[model samples]
Target chain A: GIQVEQSPPDLILQEGANSTLRCNFSDSVNNLQWFHQNPWGQLINLFYIPSGTKQNGRLSATTVATERYSLLYISSSQTTDSGVYFCAVLGGTYKYIFGTGTRLKVLA
Target chain B: SQTIHQWPATLVQPVGSPLSLECTVEGTSNPNLYWYRQAAGRGLQLLFYSVGIGQISSEVPQNLSASRPQDRQFILSSKKLLLSDSGFYLCAWSEIAGSREQYFGPGTRLTVT
Candidate 1:
């Protein structure tokens, strides 16, 4: 089983601020996704990048599979962005392993 | 686009009670279904997963069982619930033997008092 580790377990930012979240996996991954679990607890998929970079609105993610790590960038953060961001990965095995998550708080 | 549906957005039950949570996926057939539990302020825990109807694999040893009666229907059940079972349960699906990007359904928040 592969282990996933996320950096900055907790983060606080002012509105319009920028931040970076990192995820490192212990093994190669065939699948990787970034999810934003809002205050209401719905896991909203942000990106499904196994490799390369993808951008959606103010958020962007890059996965360097060769390096076994991924980075999620949040720019111009809004109050609505306040919640937990999770990184989940499907390694060589079919199952997924999730990081503990990076809790973000945006102060307006 | 594929859509996943989970029932009973929230539930409160006493210890030792029976539990059943249902999940179904649409716009796709023979998808791989999964059941996950997320404790308060915690990450998702894989409880069980199914590749197809009548095929299930348990990830953790817990008081839970999952069944897939149809190509797109997955059910998570527990004969006797424990207080420890209280958590947010999520159901997700992906194409059969295909992609890894899973589509998740709104989770069920279970509280065992």
Candidate 2:
């Protein structure tokens, strides 16, 4: 099984601040995605990046597959961004393994 | 456009009770469907996945089972629920080929007492 680790288990940022969350996996992955679990417990897909960089609005993500690491960037954070961000990867298997997640709280 | 749906949004059951959760996908054919559980303060754990109709695979041995009777429908069932079964269950779908970016539904919150 591939081990997935996420850094900064907890983060608190002021509205308008920027933050970076990281995810590191133990093995090569064919698929990698970032998700946001909102306060109501709804899991929202943010980015699906196995490699290269992608941007969506004020959020962006970069995955260096060769290094087995991924980074999620949130710029101009808002109170609505407060929630748990998860990084999940699909290896050689059919299932996707998830990281422990990074809990983010943006203060208004 | 593709969308995944799961229901009921929330459930409460007693020990040894039966459980059934339904998931369906629209606007996509032959997509891969998956079921995952997110326990309290924990990450999402893959429970089952189906590549096609009647082709189901279980990731971990548990009290639950999954069945894909239709091309775009997936179901999770348990004859006897356990206390540990309580959690947020999510249904996701992905393309059969390239990218494999899974799109998740709103999820169902189940509490087994």
Candidate 3:
């Protein structure tokens, strides 16, 4: 089984600031995705990057499969961005291993 | 566009009670379905997944079981619930062919007392 670890277990930022979260896996992965869990407990899909970089609005992600790590960037953060961010990876099985998550708090 | 649905947005049950949560996906066929659990203030844990009708895989052993009787419907059931079973359950779906970008349902919060 592959292990997924996320750095900065907790993060707090003022609105309009920027932040980067990291995810490291112990093995090669076929699929990797970023998600933001809102206060209401809904997992919102942010990006699906297996081995490249992609941007969506104020957020972007990059995955280096060979290095077994991924980065998620948040630009111009907002108060609404307060929640937990999770990185999940699917290695050689149908299951997706999730990181411990980065709890983000964007203050007003 | 594909949409995944989960029923009983919230539930509260006593220990040893039976449990069943339903998830259905629309606007797609032969999609892969998955069930995940998230403890209070914790990350998501894969419980089960289905690649197709009647095909299921369990990621971890637990008091829970899943079934995919139909192509787009996945169900999580437990004959006896434990206090530790209280958590938020999420359902997700991904395409079978092109990519594995999983889309999740709103989720169901279960509290076993």
Candidate 4:
């Protein structure tokens, strides 16, 4: 079984600040995605970056498949961005391995 | 354009009680459906997945079972609920299979007492 781990389990950032979250997988992956679990428990897909870099608004993601790691960048953070960020990867099966997650708290 | 829906945004049930959660997808055909559970302060766990009607694959063995009576409908049920079942349940759908981005429903919060 492949293991997925997230770094900086807890994070606190001020409004308008910038932060980076990282996800590391123990094995190679064919599919990778970033998600945001809001306070209401809704998981919203953020990015589906199996490789390369992508930016959406003030948020961006980079997945280095060769390195088996992914990075999520949040710039000009807002209070609404406060939530748990999770990265999931699909290796060889239909099932996805989800990282422990990075809990973020943005202070207004 | 597609949408996923789940019923009973929140639920409180007693032990040994029956439980059923319904999930439906609109505007899509032959989409892959999945059920995931998230414990308090923990990551998401894959419970079950379905590729088509009457076809399901279980990832973790437990008291819970899933059924897909229609191409776009997935149901999670339990004859007897356990306290360990208290968590957030999310229903998701993907266009195809491996590596595709999954779109999730609003989610249902279950508390078994």
Please tell me which predicted candidate would have the highest lDDT against the true structure.
Answer: 2
What is the C-alpha lDDT profile of model 3 across A32-85, one tens digit per residue? 999999999999989989988999899999999999999999999999999999
Q: Sort every candidate by DockQ, greatest first.
A: 3, 2, 4, 1
Deviation (Å) of A97 in candidate 4: 1.1
Off by over 4 Å in 1: none
Residue by residue across A2-85, what tens digits does model 2's lDDT show?
Answer: 999999999999999999999999999989999999998988989989999999999999999999999999999999999999
lDDT of 4 by residue, B1-113 (tens): 89999998999999999999999999989998999999999999999998889989999999999999999999999999999999999999987754577899999999999
Better of 1 and 4 by lDDT: 4
Instruction: Please give the CA lDDT of all the candidate structures.
Output: 0.93, 0.95, 0.94, 0.94
Q: For model 2, state the Cα shift of residue A103 in Å.
A: 0.5
- The DockQ values of the predictions, listed in order, are 0.79, 0.85, 0.88, 0.80
Per-residue CA lDDT of model 4 for A1-108, tens digit only, reads: 999999889999999999999999999988899999999888899999999999999999999999989999999999999999999998665778899999999999
Q: What is the lDDT of candidate 1?
A: 0.93
Residue pairs clashing in model 1 are none
Error of 1 at B4 (Å): 0.8
| Global lDDT of model 4 | 0.94
Better of 2 and 4 by DockQ: 2
lDDT of 2 by residue, B10-102 (tens): 999999999999999999999999999999888899999999999999988999999999999999999999999999999999988888888
Residue pairs clashing in model 2 are: none
CAPRI verdict (incorrect, acceptable, medium, high) for model 2: high
Give the candidate number with the greatest TM-score.
1
What proportion of the true contacts does each candidate reproduce? 0.68, 0.84, 0.90, 0.81
User: With candidate 3 superimposed using the best TM-score fit, by how many Å does residue A65's alpha carbon deviate from the native?
Assistant: 1.8
